[model samples]
Target: QDVFPSKGGSGTGASATRTDPVHELTPELRRARERLLPVIESLPGPIDWAVAYGSGVIHQANAAPSSPLQSPPMTDFLLSTPSPTQFHTSNIRSNPSHYPLYARLLGGSAVAWLQDRWGAGIWYVSMVRVHDLEVKYGVISTERLKRDLEEWETLYVAGRLHKPVLPLLTPPPLLPSLHANLLSALSLSLLLLPPRFTEHTLYITIAGLSYSGDPRMSVPGAENPDKVKNIVAGPGNLRGFRRLYGGLLDRIPGVRWEDGKVAEKGWIGFNGGDGGEGEDGEGWIVQPSSPAYLADLIPSLAPRLREGIAAHYRAAPPNDFGSGRGTEAGAGAGAGAGGTRRPYGSPVYHDIAFWERVVKDPQFRTVVRQELRKIMYRPALTQSVKGLFTAGLTKSVRYSLAKIGKWWKARQARSAV
Candidate 1:
């Protein structure tokens, strides 16, 4: 959207001749402004016009109360609508092929702009400005806005961006948290596995055989087929392993399985199996470059790692390593015709029950939040976390601005008082 309006429209030509000195914003605000401006400029099509909006503008009325710790707020921009519409229409009409590029450019511009300049705080204001301008200027259709909002909401829920409602809050510590949780779940699952059938050695062996030379499988003795099988085939143990896998899939961005190994490229793979024929077999492999690898690198996994371990347990003979029988019937059945049998006093049953309890338990949610914070805030995880945050933050600016309008106004009121 253009920040400048065209001549001869209702209030479009109105320009404030008055000039105020460009007051220095708090470092945070300054950073936000610096980041957002270029994005605005680079947005697909020229910015017809843009104006300052929200607390960035209102907070200017009086200097914020001096605080030793809190930083001053940043400036907000009110991008005009006609510019966006013209840009979109021109791009689509001129080269429909570029429509996707135009959208991508729009999204990228917003993201890059925010990443470089604004903190999460300014996102809300930006959204409000866009919404207000679109409604008032009739630039973007309501249908389009709704669709955009849906996409934005999906990103927020997936922890892709700082939540629009709480932009000031840091992005969700997904990778670290997932890592911790997966480990915990695994431990719990192992604890629950039936002792008679449970074999840590076997599990380690199987995993090792499967992973072999892959950096992700670098854990000592992880290659032993017996050890890996025990870990995989043992009672509740597999539950924890699956949870670990699933958690990795969720938290690690750009994770993909290639050449039978987990690797991170840019996003995580929700499913196993990279869809390639390997000399070894045809199961999904975890990619090493993925954020999940970080967990593997960590000294310990989270405590909740075991909670869901029971859910993945299989009651079957240990011989079904790659029989492909489980592939069609699912992993729950044991090898042989009688189906998997459970050993007496098997902790597998208990682990399964425990997992059930954990899923329904609210306490697990608290644990998740705690672990997430630990993993996300760690210095080592900063780069990937920042990348994910940047991806989400860009999409958030517009919507956050709309959602936080009232909050900004309230803050302005408090400052005024």
Candidate 2:
């Protein structure tokens, strides 16, 4: 049996040998993929990953058109490449009109620089029409995307992956960290949520994570107030959520499904095989109260998040401190040469007492929320500002005004009631 069924693209020396895996899409999702294939394959040579996600691709009921005059939502894509400069060069050469006049004037090197050196390490090319379909896409280097996933360096790409997406191509190299990103989201959601929550609640929390502390989300005309609820409200989207995360939930220990197991077998996940045994119903998942059990949760978090939690404990100096190799007296503690703090790097799971205090504190959830805000807020706002430039003023205004219209309508409806 072939380990990787297809080696896509005539990659340059670096991308020549790829072990791209196959995805089993649902009928609706498969059609989405089929519609997007031409656009995907037509892109500049090799890409690390290609995925379609957003309200457009998932089609939530609340986001549907209210009148015949409404245009279909543009399908959004996130593409990862080994080399952004090379990819941009090829893309701009082929699709010069896709970018704004200013971006086109800047050239590929400048565009890639703005992307890599700027907020959240992504570059956008929006509102392109291809193959009779309206499309918008963003590009980030594979390494940067992997860091965002594994390190939570920025939740930009990582957050988008939390919800359902139609992945056109996800090669072996990016799968592990991508799965780690999902696992981290679950661990955080379970940590923050009540001891018992329905599957809908879990999905809702995960979907809203990227939006938490997002400055744009606070602005009335910037986003859909019900975006998170709408994301997971419909049956189609709920099924998409199951396909994305059910496998991981099934493998977690000590979680009891109250109604029905959401994960069905044979969904492609981190293991690249079936999701193992699972049932077919939306259910309430119960998490245990054990601090020891909770400590395991902390370890799987992205390093940045894990460090934040650990720093909080160290600062407060729990009674159980110094049990697992105390910092020397007058030592820099966990600080580096420049007086910046880094992770203490000790295995945290062994510090059961530390976790006991962490989990038991009434403020634990609050601390996690604040830490998430620190990780998420700035990048989201900065990226939104960046989008204004990348998407061009006309498109940006059109997008913002559309959202404002939606916001106004929703507010007026509430007022009338």
Candidate 3:
């Protein structure tokens, strides 16, 4: 459970920077932070951050209305460690059942190698029964986690974090990065969403970032189709959604809220005016203007977040109309006071029109969809491989049958259509 190397120093371990503002503890949040944190903290590893997500956490979120004895699906944790290989090497010895026989025997170095080389920067262990909770967890280096969350390099962890999660352990210094990641996810999702949409639809679009092109989606029940709607529909969850996006929404130009929800006329539009060239004079050539209210909300973001958005446009180039096409590389650029060409990229902070251009580009949307599909397929393939190693013959048989049945039904439905 004590994952950080030290409790006192600033050398990548939990330090003074990790402190959160004191809050009047609510029973729910107290149980999550106080009770659950101890359980995760007790797990053997050097953890920089750990969060419990998926249906198990959702059940916990909804537990106020349900019986405590009710069984939920396996609790899931996504852990960030300073060094995954070292963490897995030690973790396997303490919690051998958490990993497959091969992974345990091969040692932590192999675990780390496989995660980085073959899998997304994380390795997974499933079917772990710990502290009376059935759990599955994925481990990755803290550096890689932050990178993906910011740049969305794989959209694996990025997609997962887009949804609501209960953070059992987050050191104080890492808090800002986590919040920034969520903001980046929202911005990226907005870039893919239609110009006009409802809050529920907006959350749905955000949630869909993970599942957009997943191959498992071919089988209707492989992933819940109604997941996005459900995540934002329930009052408890809706509140969580609002907590995540509310302030950000309030600052977006042309986004209006009435009575704590998005109003009908809350259509997002860009104000075309000359602003500063992107942070570096080489990223995006021109910057989009923002209202005073919206500008105040911008936060410093990861360089890759801005760079990734720029990459999409830089590939196709944009016209003067901001259509994100044509060979006019200087289309969005504004001349410097010195009248020199300043090739700008997306700002490392908020750029509403930059994101809006991304959203409006058909080619960009296609690329996003393709990348999303890749991310989705990897999990399906990884889970199946892991299942063969970890699951009993009977459980595997039943799972295969269920998948077949679901797939057949889906095929039949399509045939009828």
Best by TM-score: 2
Candidate 1 whole-model C-alpha lDDT, 0 to 1 = 0.31
- Over 1-417, each residue of candidate 3 has an lDDT whose tens digit, in order, gives 222232221225544232322112224644655545655666676777777776556442222343688554567788888777777787878887767667777898887877776546667666667777777777777787777776555667867777767665566666566667677666555655554455566677777766675656655556444445555554345445545565555455555432332122232211101111111111111123333322332233334434433444544544523543322343333222223333234242245545444444547557655545654577556644655544445545655664565456545655777
For each candidate in the order shown, give its overall lDDT on alpha carbons.
0.31, 0.72, 0.54
Give candidate 2 regions above 4 Å deviation.
1-22, 65-68, 259-282, 318-340, 343-345, 348-353, 412-417
> Is candidate 1 or 3 superior in lDDT?
3
TM of each candidate vs. truth: 0.19, 0.85, 0.68
Ten residues in a row with the worst lDDT in model 1? 162-171
Better of 1 and 3 by TM-score: 3
lDDT of 1 by residue, 196-257 (tens): 22223323432332122222123332222222333344333233233224333445433334
In order of listing, the candidates' clash counts read 80, 0, 11
Rank candidates by TM-score, best first.
2, 3, 1
- Candidate 2 lowest-lDDT run of ten: 1-10
Cα misplacement distance, residue 397 of candidate 1 (Å): 27
